[model samples]
Target chain A: MFTQFFYTLKAYKVPVSLTEWLAMLQAMEKGFAGNNLLSFYYLARSLLVKSENFYDQYDLAFREFFTGLEVPEELFDELLKWLSEETLKRHRDSVDLSSLPQHDWETLKKMFEDKLKEQKERHNGGANWIGTGGTSPYGHSGVHPGGIRVGGESNNLSAVKIATARKFRQYRKDVTLDVRQMKVAMKKLRHLRRSGNLLELDIDESIDQTCRNAGEIELVYHPERKNDVKMLLLMDAGGSMLPYAQMVNRLFSAANSVNHFKKFRYYYFHNCIYDHLNAGMEYGERVSTAQLLKNLNSSYKVVIVGDASMAPYELFMENGIIDYYDRNETAGIVWLERIANHFRNVVWLNPNPPRYWQHPTVSAIANLFPMYQLSLEGLESAMVELTRKAH
Target chain B: MQNFEQYCGTGDYIASRALQNDVNVAIALGRPLLIKGEPGTGKTLLASSISEGLETDLLVWTIKSTTKAQDGLYIYDTVQRLNDARFGDHDISDIKHYIKHGKLGQAFTSPKRVVLLIDEIDKADIEFPNDLLTELDEMKFYIPETAETVSARHRPVIIITSNAEKELPDAFLRRCVFHYIQFPDAAFMNDIVKVHFPNLEEKIMKEAVEAFFSLRELDNLRKKPSTSELIDWIKVLVASGTRPKDIGRELPFLGALLKNEQDYHQVANGETDTRSIRRPSFLR
Candidate 1:
């Protein structure tokens, strides 16, 4: 189930990981964790995501993977608004609202007021006007006049005035709409307020929207117990390893993404360790296996998966990379030995078949690690292995 | 590599068990193992990961066209012998004592066992595997002038990989184990994608991954994108500041992931104008 959610995110380019899945699972297990969510949101932020953010991502995962449910539309729309706002902030820094024409600005503000009114109406279940039974998507955006002394009786005039001013200020020439277009655009904007773009969904927006659709959970905020698990991944990157490299990278990224929510460390290694597989120079990305392992606390799990069979000496030489950077430095197998000692809960998943260990190179390398050669055909074996250790 | 717990794999067309068993057995026997597969099937990562999983030193000696058996092992200072000969009073035994440690010699002599990876052995001449006969079998080498045998304090784990461009000799192959690495199935590939590129959005992950998988066919392409390339694509997506929902520009970057220029051209041409392939309605 978690894998499905992970996959869904991967498919959409959301980049979910096993560690984050675990956290989401934990959050679900605990029912509703407001604090865990806060942490989860912060964690997702580090993924370099800003639109709907981690809250939205986690919400989508929660609905789809855990409860086997989907979030509601209203909440989803709120998140979508955030997504649009963030997207605009990211790409339209050059489009300053102060530079727009006065009339266009007024029209835009009026459009915004209409949108706010529409959202409030939907939130109020077609307009009771007082506090709605459920939480509003724009909880404190100052658009909705909650019963608590809003300093105005009948917010219609103020809403229109403020929204019109805001819209006018934010108006851009390149993003112009003619008078007739504005009428259509206003209707569309209202529609967006009520229902997001069904045709072209921002996946991140959709995820955020879907999450908002989940409404509010009975959230409890607190710190989670630190898990004694660190995941180290070794991926085959270039050459024959390249085809599956994306998969491996995604898997690693999934684990990394999931780990972002949790507090586990990870390491990356390339083909068979013969000479020292320098974790530092891998993918031109800076990470040192030596530094990670040395500093990493024990009580963690290490997993290695790859095809496992290469040239005969790939197992015996230094610098395991097929194409050496500068020198013919072969990665030594000693590197694996070093990593194995630091973490004991190690398992190897072969992207190859179990029968194929017949190859001397595969066998030779498999000899050193706790490996499970999984058939690439299904998830059963992988599922079994991943949980069997605990069972 | 064995002892993997955190490795998430990618793809949906994995090989059969017959190939994997060969790899496990070879690792157990400490024999020189040779792996074969098409490009992008993850041939090299297996060798490196095994060494990493074992926590052993991995020495990858990538075979070149000029690579020889001696290149697989250690290349002693025969040149230093001539250098020493520059002096009139060079002793034969003393010159032999100056034997420099080649990759193989270092492996055979080290206190700690090393993982020696002879990557792309097929790229070298046929003589490459023939040279491993003595050192691999007995784990020992003899210096003729010194008249002494340097045996293995520890036998380095040996793994050799080839893309099957050329078949090795019977004798050389007989000494090693073999496995054919292939693209993984969708489920496993999903796990793989999750493992490495954790921060990317799932929506694009699946679509782009499927796109990558589709490229496995179409003979016009030269090389297939590997597990590494997928991670890179994800990175590109993330770094390009694209939303999890937006990956329209991602097709052009496929050139980075696609191995064949023709395949890339095909994808580039078909995708650039088609707008639908580049930006599906569901995603946009």
Candidate 2:
């Protein structure tokens, strides 16, 4: 069994040596690994793998070698069935809110609460279930008047608040997003300051000083160039944002690499800025909008990234924050206004096409803030607007 | 037969049984143990501990973003050779004279088996690991300029660490044993604290530990306190002769725990009780 596994790793180009194989066999003779699959996995990796780079390969080989012993195929089939049913149920639960008469915030809230009380089992394609694709004032993906989206993609941003446990891939700062167009766009935020430790040789200073000192040929030193602009980026993560992941990731990576920002701080939110802004999904750090506003000075430039396509109520509904049902007297629009007021230079970067700018929710947001398409031209114009002096 | 717990003398370092087993397997297979963890989880210390336990010399090769794979194997000094040839220097004809054995070459040529630690493999370029694949697999590398292949005299116990700053190529990750060092829980943290502060009063230690965990558990903190940071905070508290209950009162020392401005303001402004903050409607 060990030999076959060893052969498997070798086939994967794990670079296990004959002597190393002998050593592993010797360790096994001493009863190193018991019947535990995890223990065996650890044992195999330690002996056969030499570099951290091959760990993923070792994992694949180990899983391949130990197939049928771990996860059962029947279990997978059951899981798939459960997932499909859940999806179908969610789809069916979505009520056509457009067909129903539009209700005021209070009435809709009251109806939503009553529906929540009566909802014993998951309902779909119904008038009342707080599930997706239905007009029920509480779930996502279906047209609903004054509805709160529970879990699913947002088409009409109708939800006062969104709630889901879905995880999002973190925007990797280390990955170089070196698209030439993005780089060109990033130049707008460039505010370089040469300060700190001496990094680059000051050629002009050196020559001037040398000439002044009777050609002593002494070299002068200047500090490294640093970006002095303070950029505060609030991004939309998850749901409809999933389709625009690559574009957002590119933007994120480019923004980080620009290295011209004296201070670059990023916080993630969904759809609109609400009461609390999440530091990151993985980090799970929740910062209150009040706290964030207080922390950042008015000098900081704020960039809001989102499609801005949601129900108009989402912007105006009290306690209508979509991710969670937090009942605040002030709505999301109030929070947006407060943030805009606090920051002297604020711009909204919409990844959604300009054709979608006519979206009720999107247009409403564009009116309140300077909205720019997330493109080379849009970024350039946004930066020009931001850099424009009081005159 | 000794485990990592034993290897990390005086400090337990939260060495899980799985990690110990993987190290043992690495020893048995003559393969490198690749450890991935968040920053400040004692990834680098593991290599030193293993070397100390085995009583072997440790050869460390710290990787930078600019570091090339050629930096690990060997460097052929063509310029130096050319200069020597022009100056009619002796041994200009000998290619060996121009060759400076790099970290890997030195480890391979060592008479005794050494512990080779390749720290922060993710810092290097995407091609860095792939470039070393042939040498790592075969335990030998050929110098194109020298037209000579140099092989390992003794198989060194290799340990590679990554913070996962960059995604390593699938081909490179497949060649090694992988272990993710998880964040220590409150109980596991107690053991680590005891190792660091043996004479700390139980009351003070418990309070400090509770406070540490509370701070770490806080969902509002961007940078969570790691094991080492917790240890440092405790050390400061002990040095000041502060009682366990007073740990929270010393607001000046709060910098040790909460590193960020927002975090400091949040805690200092009496927002430590996160439960008061509303959760999502469904979650509530």
lDDT, candidate 2, B32-143, per-residue tens: 6788865777889888888877788999999996698999999877556645664675677778888999999999999998889999997776568888887887789888
Docking class for model 1 is incorrect
User: How accurate locally is residue A258 in candidate 2, as Cα lDDT from 0 to 100?
Assistant: 68
The per-model DockQ list reads 0.01, 0.24
Model 2 ranges with Cα > 4 A deviation: A1-32, A36-38, A41-391, B1-14, B82-91, B249-252, B271-284
How high is the lDDT of residue A153 in model 2? 36
TM-score of 2: 0.51
Residues A1-391, model 2: lDDT tens digits: 3567678888866677776677666655555654233454556556655444455556556555533212234533432322234443433223322246665557766776676567665555555666655555555454543345444434343111110111101111122233434654555565558889997768778768767877555668999766678988889895888887777877787777766578888989877777788888433778888988898998788888899887777788886766554556688888988987888889999987699899888988898889998875677678877775543
